[model samples]
Target: MLPNQSFVWTGATPGVRYRFAILADAGNFLPDQCSTRWGSTDFGSRGLPGSPGFSGVPTRNNANGINVSWNDYNASYGVQHWRLYRSASAANRCSDTHIATLPRSTRSFLDSSAAFNTDYYYTFIASDLNGVNGPCSSNSAAGFRPGQAPTVSAISVSPATVVAAGTTVNLGVSATGAIPSNTVAYQWRAAGQVVGGSSPSYSFVGQGNHGTKQYDVLVSHPESAFSVTRSQNITVCRADQIVSNNACVCPGTLQEIGGQCACPPPLVRVDNQCLAPTPTPTATPLPNSFPQIINQPQSQSVQEGQSVTFGVVAAGNPVPNYQWFRDNLNPVGGNDPQYSFVAALSDNGARFKVRVSNSVGSVDSNEVILTVQSAPRPLRPVLECVMANNDGTLTAFFGYENQNIAAVTIPAGTNSGGDANLVNGGSILPGTQQPIDFSPGRVRGAFGVVFSAQGSAAYTLGYRGTGIVTETANSQSTPCAPIEPRLACVNPEGAGFRARFTYSNQNAFNVIIPSGPNNRFSPAPEYRDQPINFLAALGQSDHFEVVSSSGGDLTWILANLSATASGNSTPCSLPPVCNAGGPYRVQQGQNQVTLNASGSFDPEGLPLIYAWSTTCPGASIAGTLSPLATLNLVGNRQTCAVNLA
Candidate 1:
């Protein structure tokens, strides 16, 4: 039994406290499987019945039934099923029973059967198949035995100024009453005539009604004598005045649209007057020159998993090619404004500076030191059953975010929900669509999307609101999540050290490494930080980053002390040697002489590339430095040439 009304033990919605799962015979075992213990949101509550709606005001609708309201946040996502709890008396409020079972998306209820002078309390919870019972808050509303009529605070109008013909203005009324807001009706009057509007606001267009008009709004209730009236007046032009707009005839130039004056093409409005358009300036090409650094790199301290971006503003003759140096030594690649990546511990103390080079000489930027703090230990990836949002493909879905509470948690085990599987560190590319199914509910739906090619990539969660649901938006899942953005950050160290990041000036969010470096270090080795893919390096340069472009500077702090490297490089070996020829004999040539020079050797047995040259001017040699060579003599006496080193 719930606090309000007894929850009928029905077949479809049977469990008081239920257990649900989606584990298969294969993917995940029971021990590792995740299951959620869910709760519900509170329904509407009525305070003491005899109390007046407003403290000092008497409600004329004391005979009317009570009106109850609650938030419909779950319906916006995927959760639509709702259970309403009602208590007959204040004493029973904490022990209300589930009195009503509402379908998905139901938001409000009216209890005309509620007895007058009886204080009733209401609470509610929403759920789909895969989801657990929503949060059930115990809040305490009351229908009055109608007393005095409702009160009219004020009725007013915007723009009391005189209006041109056919101009629309707004009329608004404020009211307070014991009568439920939903039961109130509004009647707007214009010049003592009735208009067709039931809302608190009315749009009244003035079409020159003899220079002046009167308007009033009446607030009324159905079950009570509660009522109020207020009135206001406005001046309207008898007719719209014609304005001249010829460019040659008018001062400057003007055009008219919908009884308003506008400057024509080639003319623009300046202050209250129209004037000739200002000429736009064309940009001139900048001359090429050597690289000069404008904005230098700055030092940072940050938690691991966060990304950092090292940027530089430079001027150069040719667009400069950027080379980022680590420890003022190793080279990272780029020519753009920034470099970004996840931060690793190895990046700590790793100094970063950029050297921009073009046709002109290169200039190095100031080195920024990196400090990495230990990342907060990561909570296990959590999956949960949730009401579907319009961005999903199915009616029901298991959530994929990292929330730990019953409202947002994951299922334990190899529970497959449509397109969602238990893949570690899964990837969703830009523009790629994935399928999601709410488990237990097993509702199938999909959201096919092409992610944007630019900007950092991320996965975000929605707390609750008018999100997508399977029943309402069964097949049409919106690919867009609300712009609750995530960060892309990194540590300067290669990896292994945990890192985290969040904007200091904004609401805090979970720290995430959206991606590795946008571009890696050049002679910089590939970086791996996860435990298994580790590799030991002697003297290598690499890049790790934390995103700084998203409005904040990245700071990496040294939270834990790890080992630092000392000696690097192997001992030098013997250099290779080369000999010209081994016992070469040249034949006395009739027209030419052939020399045998096949034997050239190196002490280190290194493969040698051969080059041959001669100081003799008249004699010609064929295939110089070849195993065999033929020399032709132009003169009777010529010097023989044979050289190799």
Candidate 2:
């Protein structure tokens, strides 16, 4: 007994409760064989009715008899066999009777075939393969009923809500209170209008009307009327519309007023509020005079280093002060009527604004953009070999200019010079490629190129031409005359000094003594800083050196000179030899010589004298000299041009 078990002595649906017990001494108080009645009748105090039970207390179809069927109570329990019996007492006191016993699941057990209108009581026992006997469990009182009807529950629609032009919708119907083993048919209706039958769900492919469309479903069993209809509705066009919901468009002359059109100006309306006419352009009480903004430089674009000027003409109660701004914020230079800027690339897209201020007010003119661009760089010249020289050499030149010219190299077959090798850092001619000398015998004659420079560097491309050679003339050099030496510059005693030496004289002439920046000179050497000057002095037995005014401090070595043309009897006409009437003289005429000894000062400040002599015995002369010495010379005609002694 799972707790709360109650036993009732039931007969023909009478309500009562009872428990069977043995007599005090009968079978040792065992309850196996005795029966009793209990319930609202309080049968526990009355005990069992009689030792022998009454025969057929109630019969089937009689007012006191009751019939049982699972289908009448909407039960799904199937029966394979059943047994019926009757007695004058309760469950423990009844005599068992064998009724119809059949196999397999069954739903209907008819008691109508026997005893009509008579009180023939019946007890039903149903069992399946599992031996589950019917009335295995019953209510406190017997339950009876007519067959149930199929009841439909709430209906449902897939995509429950849709637009006015309703798309396909699936309808479904379900029922809970329905007869078991009975087929239920469904009928669908729209807005009380019969639409279709025999389906649990239906689809409405389109919206039936603009308003809410309602669908109802009715479920029915073959033996009963349809219980009830379940319904659901879907409303179409649920969106709010301007025309239907307080909205209007403004006409050309009228304005929208609370969703209605109305006249504006003169009866001016703003923000949905109407007002009196706006005063007719009341002579704006502006200052008597307005500051005039003048145009400086209106519109122009310039490269870096270019100047830009801006100004404005203004008329106002007070002459306005002008201040310029760049990019609408940064203050640029100004307070005057004009402003200028040296344009730079960073200044590109710069906007210039002028703020004009006076007692009345200040106003800024519309911004003007200053466009800055970069200057166009020079192009590298194209150099090509127009023709080859008689020596089968390709001589060309190019005028690529810059602050300085760095390394120059001609590549591979383009400049193998017939030895299949490259030559670098040679002379370059104007407006032509560098000369590449080659003998007329080798093959693989295409020219390749690769080069770099200091700034905005670039290289030249090589092109091949006719493989044949033609006799051509090489460039000729013009004999340059010796140039006269002008005192180029003077330095005020610095360790490392520089002076630009100029030679305006066209003919090349050798300095007979140490003159400027003179390095080592022994065997009468010569140094020329420039090509034209160096080539002009070629093969001349001459030496040039820079001598310090300080004794023994000249930057030269007399013994280091190895001139091949020494002792060739060339006159040293630029120096002391000429002034003393020695063997070196141009015209054998008197000339003055000055010696600057400023750099060779003595701390003792000793008295120094100028002594002049020549190879000629009678040419001696002497005089007290300043720290710097000067001398006058006299000519000697005899004794091998009168040697000075």
Give the candidate number with the greatest TM-score.
1
State the C-alpha lDDT per candidate: 0.46, 0.41
Q: How many backbone clashes does candidate 2 have?
A: 43
TM-score versus the correct structure, for each prediction: 0.25, 0.20
Query: Which stretches of candidate 1 lie above 4 Å from their native place?
Result: 1-186, 189-262, 269-273, 278-286, 327-333, 376-645
Residue 133's C-alpha lDDT in candidate 1?
63
lDDT of 2: 0.41
What does the lDDT read for residue 486 in candidate 1? 17
Clashes of 1: 111
Cα error of candidate 2 at position 315, Å: 4.6
Q: What TM-score does prediction 2 earn?
A: 0.20
lDDT of 1 by residue, 531-631 (tens): 21111221111222232222223222211112121112111133434455534444465556566543543222234466665555676778875746776
* Weakest lDDT window of 10 consecutive positions for candidate 1: 46-55
